[model samples]
Target: SFCPDSDLIRPHRPVNPAAASRSHQELHKELQRLSQEGKTELQRALEKRKWEQRMKASRDQEEAKKSTSPLHQELLKRHQRLENVLSSHCYCCFQFLKLRQIKQRQLLSIDI
Candidate 1:
C-alpha cells in the first residue's frame, strides 16, 4: 500500500550506534573525572576557608588585645564543626569510589 507520507518508513528517527556509544563513553569518563576532582577541590577549599577564618580570628583578637575570650571558645567550636564536615565528606567520597570500582570490575568482567 503506497501512502502519501511514505517517509514514515524511515521511522522518523535514525539510530547511529557508533555515535551513541562514543557519546556515552565520553559522558561516563567526564563524570568519573569530575567526581574525583570534585572531592579534591572540596577538601582544598575547606582547608583554605578554615585557615582564612582562623587567621582573621587571631588578627582581630590581637588587634583588640583581649584576654581568653568566650568568642574565642565559640570560634573553636565552629572550627571543629568545619573539620567534622570535611571528614564526613571525605568518608562519603571514599565509599563512592569503592562502589564505583566494584561496578567497573563487574563491567570489565562482562566485557571479557
Candidate 2:
C-alpha cells in the first residue's frame, strides 16, 4: 500500500462525453443570457439618444422663437408709431367735426 510507484499504477480517468455536452449546453445558455443583456443595453442607449435629440431640437425651436433681430425690432417700433399716429389723427378729426356741429347749433340758436 506504500509503494513508491503507486502513482504510476493508478488508472487515469477517461473524459466523459456527457459531461462535455452538459458544459457546452451551460455555455450556450450563458452566451444567450449575455446577448440578451447586451441587446437591452443597446436599446436603452438608442432610446436615450433619441430623447436627447428631441430635447435638443425642442430647445433650438424655443431659442429661435425667443431670439429677435434688429430689423424686426425696428419694424415693430415703426408699426407701433404708425398705429399711434393713426389713432391721434382720427381723434383730431372727430373733435374737429364735433366743434363744427356745435358752432352751427350756436348760430341757429342766435338767429332764433
Candidate 3:
C-alpha cells in the first residue's frame, strides 16, 4: 500500500473575482472614451469643410456682383473704346511712314 505522503505535489492559487471585474470595467471605459474622441474629431473636420465651402461661395457671389455693377460695365466699355482708338491711330501712323519711305526710295532711284 502507498503512503499518503508519497503523492505528487501541485500548487494552485484561487482567482480574485473583484480584480477581474475591475479590469474589465476599466477596459470598457477606455474603449468608450476613445470612440467619443474619434467622433468629435470627425465632426470637427466636416464642419471645417462646410465652412470653407461657404466662404468660397461668398467670394464668388461678391465677384459676380462687382462684375455686374454699372460702374464696372462702364469702365470696361471705356477701356475697349480707348483700345480701339489707339489701334486705329497706330495703323494710320504706320501707313504714313510706309508712304514716306516709298517716296524717298523713288527719288533716290530717279537721281541715280
TM-score of each: 0.40, 0.46, 0.52
- CA-lDDT, candidates in order: 0.85, 0.87, 0.86
Measured by TM-score, the strongest candidate is 3
The positional error of residue 86 in candidate 2, measured at the CA in angstroms, is 0.6
State each model's C-alpha RMSD to the native: 32.6, 13.9, 12.1
lDDT of 2 by residue, 3-101 (tens): 776666666799877657988879778767868776754677799999999999999999878997889989999999999999999999999999999
Ordered by TM-score, highest first, the candidates read 3, 2, 1
lDDT per residue (tens digit) for residues 42-107 in model 3: 667799999999999999999897668788889989999999999999999999999999999999
State residue 37's C-alpha deviation in candidate 1, in Å: 74
Worst 10-residue stretch by lDDT in candidate 2?
A: 1-10
